[model samples]
Target: MEKAKEMVVGIKELSSLPAVYHQVRGVLDNADSSIIDLANVVSVDAAITARLLHVVNSVYFGLMSRVDTVSRAVSILGMQQVHDIVLATSVSAMFKGMSPANMNMTRFWSNSVMRALIARTGAEMVRAGELERFFVAGLLSDLGHLVMYEVEPKLAEQAQMLSVQSGRPLHELERELLGCDYAEVGAALVDKWHLPPRLGAAIAGQIEPALADELYRRDAAMLNLARIMTDAMEQKMESEAIAELFDESIWTLSGLKPANVATIRLIAEMNHGEVVTLFFPQLRPAG
Candidate 1:
């Protein structure tokens, strides 16, 4: 439709996935793919491989081995963990030079990395399987909001203003005022990019917790809790609507506890200062 066209045309900041990254995605989607397949794909892209290695050895993974090769890194972190890192590193690169109006891409990506890390930690703590994909889903959950900023700055700004003034979630206000929310637009991007189905579903269903498919319901909850953790850590107001939207049983099923919420929030806040290195190696702190 017209909206789709506008989105495609206006998203000049969005970059196409590199060939190696595309191959990595393919291998990730296939059940029979192995670490050697990922290592082969990663080896072809020296820049990505370097960045991937840098990220893996960084404080994020806490690897004591000082990994220097893709194969060894894969052995240490597993194929899926590398996939999540590639996806995050790739997307982060695309947004480096992109300065959205009324929004800072650096800060935006910082917030995203924080959400992803928290989601992964929360998933592991709560026994959610495939923690890495949940991390990627958490990272991309807000992608629609980015698209809105690119495609319709005026409307995006207005929606943000309204959300702030009315204390309503931005996605809800965006749907009311603009006929669509970022979650849907983000889902469209995921489809366009041909990412894993779980990622698309997770982004699309983030705002509307009830609409997520059974397979991605856990992803939705992970993203939901990740967002809350992010906001609570930043001392921003928590999304009461989102908190109430997902049932307590989901959290219990995931093995999360109310008592640990404060601990996670504090750790996430402390980790925020290190987030820049999740992408920019040159910005990494000195030992």
Candidate 2:
């Protein structure tokens, strides 16, 4: 764990979120801060403001009327939802132009968006509150791998290759080879960033939700299931094959049955392209 924390500390400058995000966070942390105050801070950053409006008006939100201004959007979505959107967009912007070795940025983000959508859909199925948090959690779940590829490209590549060839879990190989897995590294980064403790807990416990604190175990389990569904989609597995991948514990922890996999996956696939483009417009659709 110290090693993971150290790795995050070492790359603090490289992984830092934009200043505007911090400014928004500051407003949110203030008890007296109003929606207008939050909106004012967000409006200062033209790029964030534009992206926020775009997402607000996107089909995903399903708003009856278009939102032309940040303040109106803030009123409609409430403070927490707006903050989550800012965090998500800010994170996507942070990774722009970063081309990590041995990592395909396009494919990585694609899978991430799919995972996020699946998690969000699953959350809705379970009537889990804070649906946006689930989306952000899923989107950021694999962030440890990004850090690994940046800080330890060779070892990360080796672990990835060995996982593929040996048919072992990537995190297991990462633990053996790199002394820490992507989940730990990612959780460390989340803690370092001072993002919500729940987000970090979910990331850390994703590999083994049962080991997570009971408060966050359900979230961790949801992420684990999301990753499995994303992998199934990538492999083009049949619904039955995907169902075969889940154990009873996974179903219980996630509050989802194998029967739910197909619907969750379809929701993810349908939204994947649009959400990916919303976050990463620079990425051309793959052939």
Candidate 3:
């Protein structure tokens, strides 16, 4: 209890969002917003604009020519995708240079990007709506762990060890050991950050599939499969134990048959490097 309390108290109270990002995300959320609105908002931030242009032209998207401005990027990528890239880049920049002792920042973000990409791919495979926001939700689903690690590194480490030793999921171990789990913590973080309410709820409700809204249910399902698919891609324990998380309905709803699951897993692995770079560029330098 002491250790966990220490961890919780140790985290920074203010996780600042970049001003330009806040402005741009606000514009993106407005239904009547135009591409010119995005271009104007993003153009004000030179660094963000540069990053956006670079990402759109990256080999992952396979554009024939380079993009030089936010307007061109927005025209080609559309609003949702532009929103996703901006969010990812902005969030990455905000959290960059996070202290090494708090967490393996590289691996933590790498896992997040991998899960997010896989989830986005899986969700789109089934025609899930709000695909871009869903991708962001999937990326941030495990954000509670960042707080835990920052607040109480040792206890968070213990909880993680417990998860491994006991073969229970991390969230379950968190509830037992930390009084509250990462999902709740993550939800709290989301609320504090003033993100979309549904995004926070999905993170909060990820462990309780039955209670989640349709979007959250789909969001959780995407994240769940992504985690499993990542484990498979990494060649972790290929046991049926991990497969139980799928249950019956989740698998059927995802519309990925066992064969498709295998194919997706292979694709995720084969494209790991490109996928990681697509989401998190800083990691490549670290690696």
Candidate 4:
């Protein structure tokens, strides 16, 4: 735990969330703050304003009317949802230049976006509220790996290689090799960044949802399934194979069945390309 803290602290400046995120968080934290206050903070950053409007207007929200202004978006989505969107957009922008040599930025971002979509889709299937939060959680779930690769590239690479060669879970190998896993590091990073505790808890306990606190156990379960689905997609496993990969406990925790995996994957895939391009435009191919 200390090691994880140290790593995050060491690279705090390099990995810090943008100032606008903090300002928006401040407004959200204040009960006295008005919708206009939050909107003003978000709108001040043109990039975030544009992206936030795009996401809110996108199929993700499925609102009947368009949300052209941040104030309108705030009014419709509420403070928490607006905060989630800002955090997601801010995070996407934060890591633009921090890709480590050992990682494929494009593939990494693709998988992250896929995991996010899968989690969001799974939440929708289960009738969960605050579906956008699920997407943010899924998108930021693998953040520990990015930080690990940056702070301890050699050890991180070794863990990955060993996981592949031994066919063991990467997080398990990471624990043995680095005395901490991506989940822990990721949780620590969010904590360091002053993100909501729910986000941190979901990322930390994603590997074993049963171990997470009761309040967040279901969220952890959702992320666990999302990771499985993302990995299965990456490996090109068939739908039956993907179903076979889900644990019964996870299905119970997430209120999802193996039968739902195909639909979730389809939804995630349909949105994957567009989201990847939205978050990481540099990856879009030349026309």
lDDT of 4 by residue, 74-177 (tens): 99999988998899888888888777888888788888998999999999999999988999999999988988998899999999999899899998889898
Which structure among the candidates has the greatest TM-score? 2
Please report the TM-score between candidate 3 and the true structure.
Answer: 0.86
lDDT of each: 0.74, 0.90, 0.72, 0.88
For each candidate, what TM-score against the reference? Answer: 0.87, 0.96, 0.86, 0.94
The 10-residue segment with the lowest total lDDT in model 2 = 6-15
Can you rank all candidates by TM-score, best first?
2, 4, 1, 3
Q: Judged by TM-score relative to the true structure, which candidate is superior, 1 or 2?
A: 2
Q: Please give, for residues 80-148, the per-residue lDDT of candidate 2 as tens digits.
A: 899999999998988887778799988998888888998899999999988999999999999898888
Please list the Cα RMSD from the true structure of every candidate, rounded to 1 decimal place: 3.6, 1.3, 3.4, 1.9
Clash count per candidate: 0, 0, 2, 0
On residues 30-79, what C-alpha lDDT tens digit does candidate 3 reach at each position?
A: 98999999899999988988888877887767798888888888998888
Off by over 4 Å in 3: 1-10, 100-102, 235-245, 284-287
- Top model by lDDT, which number? 2
lDDT of 1 by residue, 1-287 (tens): 24533575567556466677788988878999888888999989988998898788778677777998998988888888888889888887766666777776665676787787777777777677777787788778777778888778899999989988989988778877778887788887887777888798887777545567877776776777787667654555454433443467557534676655656556666666665666754333422
Write the number of the candidate with greater lDDT, choosing between 3 and 4.
Answer: 4
